[model samples]
Target chain A: MIILGVDPGLTRCGVGVIEAGAYRRLSFIHVDVVRSDPKSPQDRRLLTIYDGLAAKLDEFAPDVVSIERVFAQENRNTVLGTAQAAGMAMLAAAQRNIPVALHTPTESKMAITGNGKAEKIQMERMVARILNLNTLPKPADAADALAIAICHALRPAGAIQGGEREEHLTAAQRQWAKAAQKASRGRTQGRAM
Target chain B: MIILGVDPGLTRCGVGVIEAGAYRRLSFIHVDVVRSDPKSPQDRRLLTIYDGLAAKLDEFAPDVVSIERVFAQENRNTVLGTAQAAGMAMLAAAQRNIPVALHTPTESKMAITGNGKAEKIQMERMVARILNLNTLPKPADAADALAIAICHALRPAGAIQGGEREEHLTAAQRQWAKAAQKASRGRTQGRAM
Candidate 1:
């Protein structure tokens, strides 16, 4: 399954595309940041975002889109613009008949890293390892977008997201546990390189 | 000059159009409330707003658009959706190369009723009187939208919006005051009927 992730912001939005393969192996297809000029008027800025997202949707044709769900409580100054940018991303995905899923930042972090409170550097390293990249995804926002896509890809099949606790994993999900152990071991080996 | 005013909301976005003539005379061209089902996914709802605003921008081809400037500090629950809808409206206007102006609720209310804190009924009555409507504009959002357009129309030439207080009106804008007085008198007569 293909997943497109979006970390939305008015000034800079991040996008990443990946394909989840058998045994939950994830491969990176693309990662980049979409930017708008702060000097431009608000309308133009929003159009840039919408147009960029739409173009990517056409190019990637991902099966599903994952967006970082932002809370207004995060920052008073930027929440409105962030929400607007997120809205544009959502519209771009929906117009193409693609299903969109929103994951909180914490949820994405926990999926990418075992810790919900994983720091940025840790996240970049984990994302790099999972996608088997030679270098880390740069500019934070792009890395976060890729992480969100992975979060959606990691969502349990036919099970609700944000609800399943690790301890309560179903018998079939124990397979996921085994795979996660392998990924963790891979991370340990990757640190040496 | 034709002005389109949008009062943005997720469930219901209000749109109003007006023609501003010589001597600051105003006439209503259209008023509507675009709605999206709350039951629909968030992405679909945003798409509905974007499509609706785009259609209006094409149909009216307004010289300018005036959208209510929402603050994140207003209502935490709805402000995000409101900002997103406002972004859609702004994008529609910008895509058509029509300038977009944002008017705060206080500015719009002050323009319509001479009271920045005017109540909904007062704003509706004043908007009806200014536009020479037969009856009050139904739905507070639609009325607020018309009021925002009037606020934009009433904006002084080359004067910055949300600044330059009434006490500091230039000699030219004093003409707007006279026209405002005429509108106020019209409101009194409208009240009798």
Candidate 2:
């Protein structure tokens, strides 16, 4: 199965594609970053991302797309931009009728490095090792994208088919799930106020 | 001059169009709300907003587009969704090369009701009075959209032309600007960490 992974951001979005063979073998296909100028208007910046991702989707034509699910971040503006960028990635995939799977940062880390709390450098090294690349991918975002792709490749069967309705989750996945649920509750309470 | 105002949201996005005629006379052109199902996947919901706003832009063909500037809301999920929806509106406008203007909620309230902290009902009443509508626009989102359009109509000259580079601002505007600056700073700091 072919897979595309996206690490979404307005300033610098990461896009990576990989082909998964039988018995969990993986081959790197492409890796790149989509960047928008900060000086441009917000709308123009977002359009750059939207158009860039759409073109990548057409070129790669992956069977499935996996993106990092957004979590509450310390920076409101950054998080907002990240969410919008993620939305654009999902839209591009959906427009092409590609199924999308969302994975948390911890889940990707665990899949790549066997540690949910693995550091960035560890994750990068593992991604390089798994893809059999001689060197690490330049720019952390690119490595992160590869990690997301690897996560989807190693996920339990039928995870992507379920579409946000996973029937089973590992202990680490359940922990992140609980955190997501709590965060959602906090949002509802905020609306009431 | 023709103007389009958007009140961006995930569940319900409001869109309003108005024509500013000679002698400052305002004529209502259109008003409606675009909705997306909450149960749908996040990508589909965003596409709904994107397609809906794209259709509105094509139909109205307004000279300029005005959208509500998002603030740091207590509800993270809602705010994230709102930001993505607003991005869609901006993308639609930018694709058509229409100049885009952003007005804060307080700014719109002050422009419509002469009070920065006006209640919803008061703002709705003033919007109806300003638009010469016998009945208030259905759904609070529609009314909010109208208020944004009116605010753009009566704003100081050259504001939209400046494109986020306004040289001068009122005290209230400066206050909001400061808050936005602080938020940006927080984002950069988060990125460093």
Candidate 3:
């Protein structure tokens, strides 16, 4: 299965693509960072992030998209922009009917280094080792993106799918879907995992 | 001048439109709430909000779009969603090449009721009085949207314009533009107010 991972940010969003094969062997497909001028209008910066993710989604068409879930406890100066970028990534994936899975920083770190509080360099080293690469993923964000993708690939089945109905989802996901249906009563289009 | 104001939220996004006439008179144009189920997938909820705002932007073609500026200090559980909603509002207006203005909740309250820390009921009543309406605007969120629009109308001219060149902006805005231009060095499109 192919997975596209996004480390979302307005100025420098990181995207990584990887494939998981038989016996859990992984192969790297692509990695890159999208940049936007921070001093530009907030809307303009947002458009850059959105358009970048949309292009990546179209080009890769991965089986699943994994994104780092942003927390409000992050730096106050950057949390809003990060959340906006992440939102655009999710929207791009949904538009293509690709399933999405969100992994927190801790979860990704745990999956990659077996330590929730692992240092950045350690995590990068682990990523390099996992992919058998001689060099580390240059920018920190790109390495983080690959880590998130690996986390999703290693996680058990549970994710948000585009236009999915409750009956096809697991119990926990179904409960949430049922609550959504109950609130909308009749007009909601459809829910996800 | 026509202004569109958005009190952005995922579950109940409030949108309001108003016209500024001669002698500083303000006339109400429209007000409504767009809701998406919270239990639905984050992407689906965001799409609903984005589509709703896009429809309004196309229909009104407002001269300015005023959105509430969200802070990370907001309730931890809701800040991310609120920021995403506000980002979508900005995106919708930007897509139409309309100028976007951001106002804090304090600013909106001060404009409507002359008190930055006024209560919701007070602000709603002031909004009704300003619009010469006998009935209070239903739903607090809708009233807040109208208050934000009024705040933009009453403030001096200064805003984020769509695709504006650095030369056309004020000195304060120009500083930011120059910084962005310096960063991009060559390839950035145009910036805004």
Q: Which candidate tops lDDT?
A: 1
Error of 1 at B123 (Å): 0.8
RMSD of each: 9.8, 4.9, 9.2
Instruction: Write model 2 residue lDDT over B1-193, tens digit each, in one string.
Output: 9999999999999999999888778988999999999878878888899899999999989999999877554345477778788888988888899989877777687667666789999999888888899998777669899888988887644343434555577755544454445444543454310
Better of 1 and 3 by DockQ: 1
lDDT (tens digit, per residue) of candidate 1 on A1-193: 8999999988899999999999999999999899999778889999899999999999999999999876655544677788889998998888899999877776676677766678989999999999999999876669989999998888654334435666677654544454444433533342100
Give the lDDT of residue B81 in candidate 2: 79
Q: Against the hidden reference, what TM-scores do the models get?
A: 0.85, 0.85, 0.80
lDDT of 3 by residue, B1-193 (tens): 9999999888899999999998879988899998998787888888888988999999888999998877665544677788889888887877788988777776676556656678999988888988887899877679999998998886533222336755676664454444333423322321111
Off by over 4 Å in 2: A158-193, B158-193
Winner by TM-score = 2
Compared with the true structure, what per-residue lDDT tens digits does model 1 show for residues B83-108? Answer: 88898898788778999987677667
TM-score of chain A of each: 0.83, 0.82, 0.79
**Candidates by TM-score, descending order:** 2, 1, 3
lDDT of 3 at A112: 73
**Fnat per model, in the order shown:** 0.59, 0.40, 0.44
Candidate order by decreasing DockQ: 2, 1, 3
What is the lDDT for A148 in model 3?
Answer: 85
Model 3 DockQ (Cα-based): 0.25
